[model samples]
Target: MLGLESLLFLIEVGTLIPLIKTNKIKYNVEEEGGCDDLDQGDNGWKIIHTDVFRFPPFKSLLCAVLGVGAQFLTLATAIIVMALLGMFNIHRHGAINSAAIVLYALTSCVSGYVSCSFYTQINGQRWVWNIILTSALFSAPLFLTWSVVNSVHWWSGSTQALPATTVLLLLGAWVLVGFPLTVIGGIVGKNRAGSFQAPCRTRNIARQIPPQPWYKHTFVHMAIGGFLPFSAISVELYYIFATVWGREHYTLYGILLCVFAILLSVGACISVALTYFLLSGEDYRWWWRSVLSTGSTGLFIFVYSVFYYRNRSSMSGLVQSSEFFGYSLLTALVFSLMLGSVSFWASLAFIRYIYRSLKMD
Candidate 1:
């Protein structure tokens, strides 16, 4: 299964890389901007320059969430790198899970720094409150998911149920380690954060968005955004699903690392491309759209997990199904956060680069 899965993921790499190359070449510009009055190259993404960085609605909250998402994204990559380097044997499930928990708890500082930094960039007023929300929104749901799954396992007399002492210790670890790091990171980020650099001055009032064609709609963008990146990792996803459900060991740390890197590249490219389209259409609400467009890969993954559970390997008990779906949801959420953040940051950078390159008269 792992062999087949590896082959598939590699195949996906071949398919997606070409597509990315084509898009990058097609969209590559050499400093050409036409006036909006004449409407020459105004049809391009540059037309909406003013509103592109108009501080998205709920800007503070979005930044906080993105900050945490970025943190997890980095943490995941670091963990995979460590595994590939033989810091810990990737074959050991217990080791991987333990490492992940410790890393996540300890890495909250990154979340705080990123979230608060962005928040500060947007000139958010309530720094402390914003940081609090960032930590809670990310950690609370995951903790609940874990608790639910553990309770289900405990009810079924499965050893997967973490003992009460261990659960308490996890809570203590979060409070002692995660929370403070987040606060410290938040403080440092806020103090050091610079203003968001927008190439063009944003307007106090927003421009009316024209009705978009069906292809430019959220559903269309979500489908393209989600599936393209998801396709890149679908084969590897099968192995991951199999290991989780089949209770098998995952030892492909090197392949896993490669897949992780490719996924990030694919995510960023797709995001920038899609954001360009949105901006060209004069739709300025791209902040969340960028996140959701790329994050929809998680939704696609969840859908595939349903297929995997139903058709692929078989472990058809209450505890098994519950654990599979529950953890899968968390997995999707994490992917949405991690990869989506990558996409957004890339899009943000691309937008800034392109806008700055233009000669605004």
Candidate 2:
């Protein structure tokens, strides 16, 4: 898997090199007194400079989603680092879950800071609603899933169901620790926020986006952008599934950490490449597209989970199936946010760098 990822990474980097060169050449031509007219058959990214930084619609929701993604990125890194340091027994699932819960509560401030700061930067007026949305982005869905799964377990009198007191304590932790920290962070973020600084000035009239090729469509982008990252982790995913559902034990935190890094790198590279393609087509709606493109990795993971459950595992019956699929869905959601954020940040950086280097007035 590592070898394949390394090869794929090299290929992605190779693909990006030419795009970067083309952008640089276009900028140089403009600087050298070449034609500046957009209609002169120069279909490069320079033509859409004015609209490149336009804030996408639903700015508040986008900010909240990005904020949650940042939080998950931090949480995953921290957990991996602690595991590498032998902070807890890898064989004990309960220990890991408890630690993750505590860390997530502590990390609530990160989500608040990111979401609120981004919202402010984008000129969002609904600060209160933005913060509320950020706080509930993942938690709400999780609660709903937990309720369904727990009810199933309760009806079956299974010991796997969490006790009512435990559920209350979890809620209490989020309400008291997580909520307060998020509010505090939101206050800080709002105060520290600055204006959105796009290198190119936007025009009063938005440019009409040309019809894109079939390959540049959102679904195609998702399929292409999601597949490489999913392939990078697919082999390791089986081992993880085996460890969790089967009797196997996994202690190679180091390898897992490496695969995790590769996953992020692949997601970022593919997103940047796709964003470049979209921009070359004079499409500036790259914000959500960049996210959804790579975020589709989660969809692939969920589909793989179905495959794993049907063929790879020996488990059976309603209790196990519901639990497996439910948690698998949550895992998919996490990956979507994590990789999606990485994709967005990467594309944003790429866009800014190219625009900033241009000879624009």
Candidate 3:
């Protein structure tokens, strides 16, 4: 599947590169007040270049989401590298969990910087609110889930519940270290930010998006975009699930690393392809669509978890099920943000590449 996707992406790049070059030539001639004999009717993507980079609706939320996604990407990569280098025993779940917690706190600045810089570029006025949103984007929901799961465990008198001191320590770490670093990063980012550098000038009024076919709709994109990346990692995911829930110990960090890379590549490729289709259809609202298209992979992950729980795992009961699904939900959320960020950035780069060479006012 990965090979096939890569082939298709290569084919797409080959086909589009010449078209982009041709469009650039014609656009340059038009700009110089010269006429080109070639018909311009086929330049669907070119026609919407003006609105392609326009800031999407809910720009603040988009910036925050992307920022958190960046943080997750950094954390995941760092952990994988450390594990591959044998810095810690992969079987030591406690050590791994502690390292992950510390790394996540340390990476808070990444989210802050990315979110604030992006918001600033889009000319956002509420810098303070943007920073707050970025800080709380992932943590808030996570805290809520943790609270519920901990309460359930505590009520059941299970040793799995975190002690009060440990919980307080985790909270203190975030409040003192994570939040401050995020604030500092946001301040720095805001100071360094500049106006958005769009290739073409946006019109005073927004352009009307043409009616798209059913296949071009957001749901269809999400289904197709999410499925491809999910398929790429589905087999590896079974082993991961077994390691986490069953008694099996997974130590294949190398294969895990390779699968992770393939997952991201497949996601990026599918997203770029979908964004191109959206642009060709004259749908300028590709911003959120790009995210959701690949982000939907998380939904598939959660669905697979349901299947695993039903068919594979023997664990049952309210407490166990609650704990399993709660953590699974968090896992799904992480993947969604991580892959969504990759998709959006890939599409953004592709859009910029194709539009940058055109001579547009």
- In Å, residue 183's CA in model 3 sits off its true spot by 0.9
The full ranking of all candidates by lDDT, starting with the best, is 2, 3, 1
- Stretches off by above 4 angstroms in model 2 are 1-41
lDDT (CA) per prediction: 0.83, 0.90, 0.89
TM-score of each: 0.86, 0.88, 0.88
Candidate that beats the other on lDDT, 1 or 2, i.e. the better one:
2
lDDT of 3 by residue, 1-361 (tens): 4798899999999999999998787656655432233323455877776677778888889999899999999999999888888888656667778899999999999999999998999889898999999999899989999999999999999899999999999999999999998999899999998878676667666778888999999999999999999999999999989988887877889998999999999999999999999989888899999999999999999999999999999989878998999999999999999999999999989988887666443
Instruction: List ranges where model 3 is wrong by over 4 Å.
Output: 1-43
Q: Candidate 3: give its CA RMSD in angstroms.
A: 12.4
TM-score of 1: 0.86
lDDT tens string, model 2, 56-128?
9999889888989999999999998998899988668778788899999999999999999989998899999
Instruction: Look at candidate 1 and tell me the lDDT of residue 87.
Output: 83
Question: What are the per-model numbers of colliding residue pairs?
Answer: 0, 0, 0
